[model samples]
Target: MPPFDPLRRRLPGGLRAEHALALTVLALVGIAEGQRLGPGGRTTPALVASWLLAMAVCGALLLRQRHPVAVGWCTVVGTGTYYLLSTVDGPLVLVPIAALYGLASSGRLQAAVTMAAVMVIGVGAGALAGTGDVNGTAVFMLTGWLIAVVALGAMWHGRMAYAEEEAALRATQERLRIARELHDVVGHNMSMINIQASAALHRLEKDPAQAESALAAIKAGSREGLRELRRTLGVLRQVDEGAPTAPTAGLARLEELIASSALAEMTVTVKKSGAHDLLPATVDLAAYRIVQESLTNAAKHSGARHVVIRLHRDDAQLRLSIEDDGHGAPPGPAGHGASGIAGMTERARALGGALTAAPRPQGGFAVHAELPLSDNKTATERSTR
Candidate 1:
């Protein structure tokens, strides 16, 4: 069998030490009370007996915090008996603090309150009997210690509860972060591959060499993206994912994308305005995927024979618009019709981009997305990381 845990092994030894110390104190007080003093200013037989009795009662308290309710009641019964039977100090006066610590930490608010009330009543009764004087210093001391015990216990328990809550929150946030990263990986890569493959298939007979090139790019792109994905996941295991990827595809894929759709005899026109080069990887990937989804949907469902794809960029944003004379938007629930359009929107929104879809007045439908351009530094960090 495996060895016992260090903490658990130490626990029993610590408890034994505490119990032994309590008993030793009790025995010393008992013996001291039995000893005779040479002169007048010293202890009497009654005082000695009271101290001995108090020690014995206090010794019962060693396990009070471990079993609060049981120990507390034991203290009350033993202390009350000793007070009534012999004119000795009240039994178990050292127990209230331990019982209070256990009660507050238990998470049983009602039980703690009930125990507190019992302690107050028992201490009052002990005071009334032990000193035979209602207004005595012993009453004040007991009351002060009881209040301090309960307060300290409550504070320590509160700290422990807060720590548990913070840990849970951190775990939840980490899960959300991982979910978002995985979404980007799977969504962006698959959309591009599907688009490029469709394009290559369209011209495969006419331009066999180019078709082969596109096919090879598709394979290489997918492999590189998968490698990057593994690296992203490796962070969770605290392992290095090796090198980051520079999986080469940009605005150039738009031509192959449109040309492929044209192979299906669906005429496609692509237009660009302003400087569209050197975009953030995420924005570029999102733009490609959005247009890719639009073209794919046109081929899959739209009856419109002609398509228009427009790409535009200014200083702050990149714009993509795709329209076909195909049937206007799917009939009902997004999931029931085509799921890609909605997924594209979600992908765009993840990068602080916007997507819109609406029916055309004449016929068919149009899909467009505008993505924000984060500063260069942030984009570089995302790509390299």
Candidate 2:
């Protein structure tokens, strides 16, 4: 037994057209044979009645796909009566053939079995009593064709069910991925922003300038965090319509980040000595995020007020360095992140770049990442035009 598939179901009008065509052909052939039965029998009321009944049975197939079990049983019963009255040939048999498979595929094994039994009993009994087409090769051939149709319908039902299940599984996995990314982005930023906002609110009356600036930074950080989250969700959309093709936070936005760092209580410097060219969008965005996260970490965890951020580019690569004059080394995984060094490392690696953070023997923490330019050469990656 197979379940119904809404997506795979054929339209009602199409199914009706198919059934009507089959029955029309069957009826024409049947009427031709009856006309050939000689003048005495051709116009008999009993003969005419049988022909009309058989024609009605053939047309019954219009309901086959929708009510397969009911139609199949009705076909079996009507076919038996037509056979008894000697006019069940031609398109009349199509009703049973068309409806039988749909019955078997409608997720009702018991009903399918009952209909199958009726068809077999009706046909077998009629053939035995009337000496009909049972002994002919065509009988076996037609039975084989009908059975194949039933089997094919069952296969379709199974395949459709499997496809739906696979689609649902994929949707669940996507939801989980979105959940994880949102949690990582919001959890980290909200905690820091909340603390800063609470402090600013408490000091609003005492130090108006410091409180106002703190509140402003909180608002900016929160807005940026929301923007990043929205971008992540956008990736899950089915269509690319109206969505940004590339990330917005690239190297060009570095100055605003430096200002945020200064507000977060870190002394930040930006030094670019070489000519600046447009970087590959992904690389530029990664660079900015690396710098931003590092500065945030310094503000939160490091005792350092002084941080140096240098973006230097050669013909082949761009090197970004962030060093904090903070308390010794970060203790655990998030050590760099208390200021955001660990987050910076992750951002670098995600863009096919490499990151290294080591304790400065003289003082704070130093973070470095080397990103390859599209026109540049590196020992590991040689980019081509």
Q: Largest lDDT belongs to which candidate?
A: 2
Worst 10 residues of 1 by lDDT: 3-12
Candidate 1, residues 139-230, lDDT tens digits: the string is 67767776776676666566667655555555654575456556545554565567568869986999988788778767865875586577
lDDT of 2 by residue, 1-385 (tens): 1443642343234565556665675667576557646566646666776767676676666666666666677777887677667643555665666566565455454565566556665565646666754643544565566567567656655666666666565565456545545654565467458657877988899998989888888988788778777777777666645784445767787776676566656678888867577888767866876766566556665667899988888777789998889874564754435334545554555455788877788888787898877633321222211
lDDT of 2: 0.65
Candidate 1 segments whose C-alpha is farther than 4 A from its true place: 1-94, 129-141, 195-207, 239-385
TM-score on alpha carbons, each prediction: 0.54, 0.59
Clash pairs, model 2 backbone: 26-91, 296-339, 297-339, 297-340, 298-339, 336-341, 337-340
Model 2 poorest 10 in a row by lDDT: 376-385
Of the candidates shown, which would achieve the greatest TM-score relative to the real structure? 2
The TM-score obtained by model 2 is 0.59
Which residue pairs collide in model 1, if any? Answer: 304-325, 304-326
